[model samples]
Target: MYNLKNKTMKNFMTIALLLVMVNTYAQQVDSIKTTKVETVTDTVNGEITSKKIKTITLKEQAVKTDPADKGKLNADRIFPPTKVKKTVMVDYDADPFYDEKTTLKYFELNNDNYVFRKSNDGFIMNVLNKDEEVLKANARQTKSGPYYVVNSNEFDGIGFFNKEKKFVLEFYNQKTDKLETIEFAEK
Candidate 1:
């Protein structure tokens, strides 16, 4: 029985070797055939005619929404919408406010035009302006974004953030009347 098993194993090995050899030969033949190219040209004679491609340009007149003679045209540009700018009001005239028994109220100024609120911690002088902000040693570091430095005060050219109930920022700029915020990572 061992002799019979050895004979069968040898036959199977021979068949496997034959199959591998057949597959390798098939692949090599295919590779050689793909590299071979066949080109055939047959000529048919006809009368030669000159052909020119001419481009027709259609000039489209801009459709006039408002008639040329209908409305009066102002020479001056319609400003504001066309010209964008940082229109932070220079609130230099805001009066001072102090804490009362519980609520905060403005001091006796020229008019009853000032209003104040109690700070979360202590006194927060909000009526200060751009020039007044420069007085403080802790000036916000604003290198990124559109920043314009006037004297020592830095203003974002685009705009300032708007907060609830006229409160603009961590510290409001009394000079420029814009909200001032400390928004830079310490180096």
Candidate 2:
């Protein structure tokens, strides 16, 4: 009789523990919602107007382990948010021009002006107002397409004439590790 009572007590304890664990897991939330409010004020001709904007966002809570994706590493749970890529914009002090005596062509990119002219053995790029030479490189004509291979110490650029007769220059910037493009519209 004592042995039977002990067995029953063991079964009861095991069942109670399983019920408690199942109840806790069932109460877990799958997603969360957040609300945000923004206020804007506008003034026009001495008149003022005020407005409020309300926004609601829903986000999924990260699951530590997914049953459907068993045995696979969860990259989302292990890795943090991705970092934003940093880009450097070209800056020019002056507007460049194409002079019949020296420059082969003139180009503008991102509102910055530049002149491409022939050097002794390569091409030289200069900013109209700046005293320093921006880039110097030799070009190779590729038979594959209308692209010209241009190289410099800091950048490697590929130039091609587009369908609209516009010259498009793509540069691989070494410092920022980004691709920069400039367009030269034919006049």
Candidate 3:
């Protein structure tokens, strides 16, 4: 009788431990179902300024198990749908006179207005009159894209096309000792 009682108690203890383990595992799965992730990006002047990722756990839901339908899992019924919000920011400032198609490297700037063209020989500075005629003073590429710099007694800047095909220009400001950027986007 003593041996039989000991065996019964051992069985009860083993069953209790297994029940605790199963409950713990169920809680872990429930936690995973309620987890949410969010992503955010900020862009300035066609460049990524910052990115952020965050994860959060939502309220727990009551899950039901059917002994008759064992091993058949319905994911939609087990976990409800969650909505995530994403945010992005873009900033652009473009120069009005730069043209990407012309084969010359020189650009004309007159009273805050200018025209840019590519040339094979050297730098070309032209002053445009009221009739839109070119008055050549100093300078003058291929149809293919190449990085180019425009520097003259009055204007100093660099122009290039980015991978996204956006025309970007950086102008040096001698008075403030800073570089001002201008970008032209196709879209």
Candidate 4:
């Protein structure tokens, strides 16, 4: 009877230890969830805008014991490989010329005082509402042909003549600080 009592106590102690280990493992796995939040804001023309983004990640906490390593946890098997992704966003006010999806050939300059004309001699600055011509500069000649360079002065850019003898003008926009290309086909 004494031997039987000792065996039963030993078995009870073993079951209790197994239960404790299982509970500890379950707790570790449950703690692997994480949450992250991000916010972005921008101010344009006296108006403020903001955006919030959230991310949730879960990692596996289970480790496999390697038989070859004397029952030690395998470092490579503990964590799974994850892939990273990247995103890009673009935001800007709508531009009329860009929204049209057509290449510009003409632009009114200085409150309609001058109309830019594209010609073989680069862009011609002409008086608006008049047939008078103001200034004409020939595009710089290259081995392939005349390739105009866009500059700040607007008139200091290149012009190309199509078969119809109309001008295509490329110049710099001072306000937007961008290069603009337009074609003026009207004779």
User: TM-scores of the models, in the given order?
Assistant: 0.17, 0.33, 0.28, 0.27
Which candidate should be chosen as best, given TM-score against the real structure? 2
The candidate with the higher lDDT, 2 or 3, is 2
Candidate 4, overall lDDT? Answer: 0.50
CA RMSD of all predictions: 35.1, 20.4, 24.0, 24.2
Error of 4 at 83 (Å): 62
In the predicted model 1, the residue pairs found to clash are 128-174, 129-174, 129-175, 130-175
**Model 2 error, position 71 (Å):** 70
* lDDT for position 75 in model 1: 32
Q: Model 3, 1-187: lDDT tens per residue?
A: 9999999999999999999999877764333323233334677799875333333323333454545667777423444322221122222223332222222222223242233333454334444466473644332222344655656664467666689555566778888788887664422
Model 3 TM-score, 2 decimals: 0.28
lDDT of each: 0.32, 0.57, 0.48, 0.50
Instruction: Sort the predicted structures by TM-score, highest score first.
Output: 2, 3, 4, 1
Candidate 4: lDDT of 30? 25
| True-vs-predicted CA distance for residue 77, candidate 4, Å | 82
Better candidate by TM-score, 3 or 4: 3
